[model samples]
Each structure stands twice: as structure tokens, then as C-alpha cells.
Target: MIDIFGTLGPKCDNEIMLKEMFLRGMTGIRINLSHVKLFDCKDSIDRIKQAAKEAGTTPKILIDMQGPELRVGDFDGVVSLAKGYYQTLGDEWIPVDEKIIRAMEPGDEILLDDGKILAQVKEVKGTTAEIYVKRSGGLTGKKSIRIVGKEVPMPALTDEDIENLKFASEYGITGIMQPFVRNRDDLLAVRNQLQISGCPDLRIYAKVESMEGVENLENYINDCDEIIIARGDLGNAMPLWELPGVQKRIAKTCREHNKPFMVVTQMLSSMEKSAVPTRAEVSDIYNAVLDGATSVMVTGETAIGEYPHEVIKYLVNTANEADKKIKQNKTGE
Candidate 1:
């Protein structure tokens, strides 16, 4: 059976709620290290273990590591920028930080907030530059920022990520999901860190989000035990319309390598506010299963959804039915 991994959040944190989710076909739980604190995550793991024991099921735990994610420095609030407009940060209207002024010359592209919006450095000066917003969108505080052409050098694992990984090791989690994997070297560096942390045996899930990650899929897959098609930042990285093709490619690559591949992000966005899923959302989940995805994840749906249990139940039913149909088709029934 295809495992159903549900993201645990405030909705499914309590013992009672987790038990209900497990009964509803949540075989695995994903703990997003980006949001919850380390102590809280440990507490969640304890509750999940207790719940799993009570339900007589072994639920695999996947601890997500926040990689070298670049984000906009502290913003005042939600700031909206218009097309062909520029916002001044640190006394300059540049697309990226002033630190890169020396590295970036004219016509250098800058990716801001997980590559949602694009910009180019039109001119450069001392510690500042004039950048044209190539793409337009709302700019929020702490969204990931990146330089398109220039390789921003950062450690594979951040300080917080190391602490989180250590906690996961001490707690005996089943796996680790490395986010924003850029290349094989990134995976190896993370693996080395895990070894240093004495977590060499834990399974690693390489998340393909950026263009670089997609380009290096085969190498990344070879270095990790599994792959997660994390479309949230991926959509932000590329045009949203290109996500389907990327999803199919990732699924194919994982299958060829015999590695588990999961499809994640907004599988049930509507369910975040409603107990029911939209027809499109249902089709999305069904299609991911049809595409040979080993597992489908519900992020906000099970995280902060209004009807978390209902969302899980719906996903379980949808995936179960889809799996049956696929098997039947294969059997020529």
C-alpha cells in the first residue's frame, strides 16, 4: 500500500487527535522544522509515539531540515511592489543585498523570496545598486532570497538545522528531509553532518525545489534514500505552470532508482479552511498517485486546517481508491 504521510501541526498535535489521524490512514508523520521549536518538536514526537503505540501501528517520523535557505532581511510588514518599480532597502533600490554589489555587475539576475519574483541589477556602485524588478509580486518579511547567476556560498546545514538534526537523532526519528538540495555535494555535506551527529542510519529524503536541484536530480537521488517533490518553493522557483512536468520527471527518476518519492504542497489547500476538498484538489491527489508517486502529503490541510481529521480521511479514501483502481487496471480486472 502507498504510505499516507500527513504533516503534523497544531491540529494533530494532541494525543487524541493524532490517534484519530492514524486511524484515518496517516501511516507517516512529517515534522516541519521550519515552524515548530526543537522542544515542541520533541514533545510532538513523544505524543505521536504514544499515539502510535495505542493504535498498534508503527508510524514513521520524518524530520525536515531547513537547509541554507536565503530570505529577505527583516521587513516592516507585508510590502507590495508594482511592476517596473523598485524598493529601497538600506538606502538603495536594489533587487538583492548590497553585500553582492562587488560580485554582481550589470544585467545580473536576482531571485528573491524563493525565486517568486525576478530582478536584474541594472547598475552597481559602492555597497548599493539600481535593480529593475523583472517580475512583480508582494514582498513579505523573511521570504527566501537568492542570486540567479551568482552562486551564494553557504554551509549545507545551518546552525539551527544541526540542532534540529541532533534532536531528531536523540529522539530516534525514522528519517530526515533535507530541504532545498542544490547538488550532490549538498547531500554529501548533510550526510557528513548526520554522521558527525551520530545519525548515520537515519533515512534521508532529498527535496527537489530549485532549478539546480531539478537539474541534478539523478545525482541527488543517488545520494539520498528518498525524494520529496516539494512544490511550494518549487513553484516559487519556477513558473507554476511547469510544476506538473517537473513532478512527472521527479517521479520517473525516483522510480527508475527504486527510491520512494512523495508529492507534497497544497494537495488540499481549500481544506485548510474547509472540511471538504475542491474537485480540482481531489484530482490533483489522484493524479499524483497515478503518476506513480509513492506518497502524497497534505501540508496546511493537516497542519492548520479547520477540519484536520476530515482532510486526512478524505486523502486516505481518495488515495486508497486510486490505488485499488491502479492495481485493478494492472491486473486487467
Candidate 2:
């Protein structure tokens, strides 16, 4: 079966809605720890457990670790970036990793909020930089930041990530999804933590979200339990036009190595607001299965979308149809 994993969020945060999703064939739930502390997610975890119990299945609880990812720091309501204007990046105004600011050069590009907002460094002054907004969009707290064509040196795991992995070991969580995994050593660090926490058997799903991760994907596939083609930040790591080919190559490599991999992010993005997904979205899901994806995941669509169940209905239907076609081709029916 093509396992389906839905990100837990506000819309499907309760038992009733979660049960509805489970009944519709969702095999697991992904708890993203980017925006909230792991200790604060007790109620959410309880809700997932209760919902899974009522559905009569053992659901996989995967904690998405925020490992060495640079993000816009905490803030209130969204900040609007206007085109052709300068925005300050510092601890006071728009908080970001000082390392990122220090690494900035006049021409370096910065992608914010999953590449939605684009900016370029206009000038650097000591610990901050003046960023010229190239593409204007709303910026939210804890959203991602990426510098084009550059790999910022960061630790394999953050201190918070270590604490969270230890917490997951005690909580019976099924797996740990390590984000921004760049090399074999990244997975090794996670594995070491899992061993220290005494949950060494927990699956380590490496998220390939950087050029380093892509260049070293074979190491990830060989060492980690699975590969997550996190197209959002991965797209930011390279030219947007090259994303499709990159995804295909990753999929092919995973299949050749007999490793499981998932295609995630924006599967049915339109359904986040609309009640129905676009035809192109359906085609995207179908073709992903045809490309030898072991599973497909929906993030914002089910996590905070207007039609979470409807979105899964479309995903399940589309992927199942693709699976059926593959079966027929194999059997000569």
C-alpha cells in the first residue's frame, strides 16, 4: 500500500477530525516541531493516540525535528515585505540566525517562508544586513530561510532537537524525521541520539532539503530508514526549474537502492482553501506513484486546510488508481 502521512495542525488537531482522517486511510501523523516546543505538544499527542485507538489501528507518530534549519525568529502577526525596499535582519526587527546575517554578501539571495518571499543582500554592517526585497510576500514566525547556492555550516542537530529526540524515545513515537539532513554524518548523529535515548530501533527518515543533501542522497538512502523529498526547501536550494528533474533523479536512486521514500509538500495545495483540489494536483499525486514513490504525504492541505478529509479522499483515490495501473502492467491483464 502507498502509506499516507498527514501533518498534524490546527484543523485536524482534535480527536474527531483526526479519527476521520485515520478512517480515510491515513497511516501515520507527522508532528512538526518547528513552531512549537515538544513539551507543549502533550495534548496534541494525546489527541492523536485517542483518535488512533478509536480507529482500531496502531498509527505511526513521526516527529519532524528542526535540525540546523535557519528560520525567521518568533514574532506576532505576519510582516509584509514590499518589493524594491530594504528590510533589516537583526535581533530586534526581524530576528534571524546571526551566522546567516554575517555570511551575507551584497548579491546573495535569501528565500523566506518556503521560497514565497525573495530578497537579496544590499549591504552588510557588522552583525546585520540590509536585505532588498526581490519578491514581496507575507513572512510568519519560524518560517524557513535559505541562501541561494550557499551551504551554511551548521550542527547536525540542535540542542532542542536532541531534547526532542529523547522525549520521543519515551513517548512511543514511531520515527524521527530529521530535516535538512546533509550527509551521512547527519544521520549518524541522529542514530547516536536514538541509541543514547535507548530507542535505537526508531526509524530515521532523512529529509533532503539542501544541495549537500541531494549530492549525498545515496549515503542517506543507505544509512537512514527512508528519504523524504522535501521539495519546499529543496527547491530553494537550487533553481526552481530544476526541481522536477531533481525529484525524478532522487526517486530513481531510491528505487534502485530498494529504499522507501516519500514525496511531500503541496500535494493538494489548492484544497487548503478550496473544497476541491485542482486537476493538476491530482495528476501530481498520480505521477509521483508512477515515478516509484513508496508513499506520498500532504502537509498544509490536511494540517490546516478547509477540506482535510476531501483532500485525503483525492489523494487516496488518485494513488490507488495509479497503484492499480501498475499492477495491471505487471500482470499483463
Candidate 3:
């Protein structure tokens, strides 16, 4: 089976909505730990378990850890970034780590929101950097940010990630989706923490979201329980046009290594608002199955989408159709 995972959020966190989703063939739930605390998620976890019980499925609870990934701190709502305007990062505008400010140089390029927004450093001051916006886009809280070519120094796991790990089993988290996983060391750190937390058996899904991670993917596939093709930030790491080929390569690698892989990010993006997916989005999911994806996932489409259940319906129906096609081809029937 091509496992389907949906992100849990306000749009579909209740028992009825979740049970409907589980019945619709969602195999698991993804709890994103980037913007919320694990402690605060106990009730939601309980709700998910109740939903799963009613649906008669043992759902895997995967936590997307806030690892070494850099992000813009809290903001009330969408911040409109106008083109050709100068903005300060690491200050009042968009707060970030000092390591990010220090690693940047004047003229260095930065990509935000998975490369949907682009800016270049104009100058660097005490704890902030002034950047010229190259592409205009709306900025939101906790969106990803990365320097074009430089890998900023960051711990493999953040303090919050450690805390989450310490309490993972208490919340019935079955897997860890380690973000910005650059090498074996990063995966090892998570493994060690899991050992310390006494949930060493939990599966670790290393997220390939950077050029560094892509360069070292073989080791990740070997050490980690599974690989997550996190195309959101991974798309930011390189030219946007190259993302498709990169995904194909990653999928091929996993197939050769006999490792399970999950393709995520915007599978049914259009359905986030619309009841139906765009033809292209449906084709994307279909091809991903043919490309040998062990699983496919939807993020905002099911988490915050207006049409959460409809999105999952399209996701499951489309992927399952492709799965049937694959079987027919195998048996020449």
C-alpha cells in the first residue's frame, strides 16, 4: 500500500473529521512541532487516538521535529514584503538566529517561504541584516529561511526538539521526521536522543531539505528508518526548475536502496481552498506513485485547507488509481 499521511491542524483535528480521514485511507497523522509545543498537543493526540479507534486503524503518529532548520519568528499575520524594498532581518522585521546574521555577507542571497520570496543582503549591522527584496511575497510566522550557498552553523537538534523527544512516547509519537538532516551525525544525534528518551525503537524519517542533505542522502537512507523528500525547503536549496529532477533522483535512490520514502509538500495544494485539485497537482501525485514513492503526504492541503476532507479524497483516490495502474502493469493484465 502507498501509505497516506495528513498533517493535523485546526482544520481537521476533531474526532469526527479525523475519523472520516482515517476511514478514507489516511494511514497516519503528522504533528508539526515547529509552531506548537508537544505538551500542548496531548489533547489533540487523544482525539486522534479516539478517532483511530472508531475508524478501526492503528494510525502512526509522526512528529515533524524542528531540528536545525532556521525560520522567521512569530508575527501576528501575513507580512507583505514588497519588491525593491529594504527590510531588516534578525530585528523587528523578521527575527532569526544570530548565526544566520553572522554567516551572511553583503550581497548574499536569501530565500524564504520555500523560495517563493527572494531577498539579498544589502548590509549587516549589530544583530540584524538589511536585505533588498528581490521577489515580492507574503511572509508568515515560522516560515523557512536559508542563505543561498552557505550552511549556517546550527545544532543537529534544537532544545525544543530535545524536549519533544523526551516526551515523545508519552504522546504516542511513533516516528520522528527530523528536518534539515545534513548527515549521519544529525541522524545519530536524534537516535541517541531517542535512546535516552527510552523510545529508541521509534522510526526516524530524515528530511532532505537542503543541498547538504541531498549531497549526503545515501548515508541518510542507510541510517534513518525512512527518507522524506521535503521538497518545500529542498526546492529553496536549488533552482526551482530543478526540483522535479532532484525529486526523481531521490526517489530512484530510495528504490535502489530498498528504503521507504515519502514525498511531501503541496500534493493537492489547489485543493487547500478548492474542492478539487488542479489537473497538474493530480498528475504530480500520480507520477510520484509511479516513481516508486513508498508513501505520499499532504501538508497545508489537509492541515489548514478549507476543503480538508475533499483534499484527502482526491489524494487517496488519485494515488490509489495510480497504484492500480502499477499493479496492472506488473501483471500485464
What lDDT does each candidate get?
A: 0.79, 0.88, 0.90
lDDT of 1 by residue, 173-284 (tens): 9898888898999989988988988889999888887888888898778898888899988776666798888888888888888888889888888988887889998998
Clash pairs, model 1 backbone:
70-145
Per-residue lDDT of model 3, residues 279-329, tens digit only: 999999999999988889999988889987788788899999999999999
Span of 10 residues, lowest total lDDT, candidate 1: 88-97
Query: Comparing 1 and 2 by TM-score, which wins?
Result: 2
Which parts of model 3 have CA positions greater than 4 angstroms off?
Answer: 75-78, 91-93
lDDT of 1: 0.79
- Residues 62-119 of candidate 2 have per-residue lDDT tens digits of 9998898988788999889999899998868898888888878999999999889999
In terms of lDDT, which candidate is strongest? 3
Worst 10 residues of 2 by lDDT: 163-172
Q: What does each candidate score in C-alpha RMSD?
A: 3.3, 1.3, 1.5
> Any runs in candidate 2 off by more than 4 Å, and if so which?
none
**lDDT minimum window of 10 residues, candidate 3:** 91-100
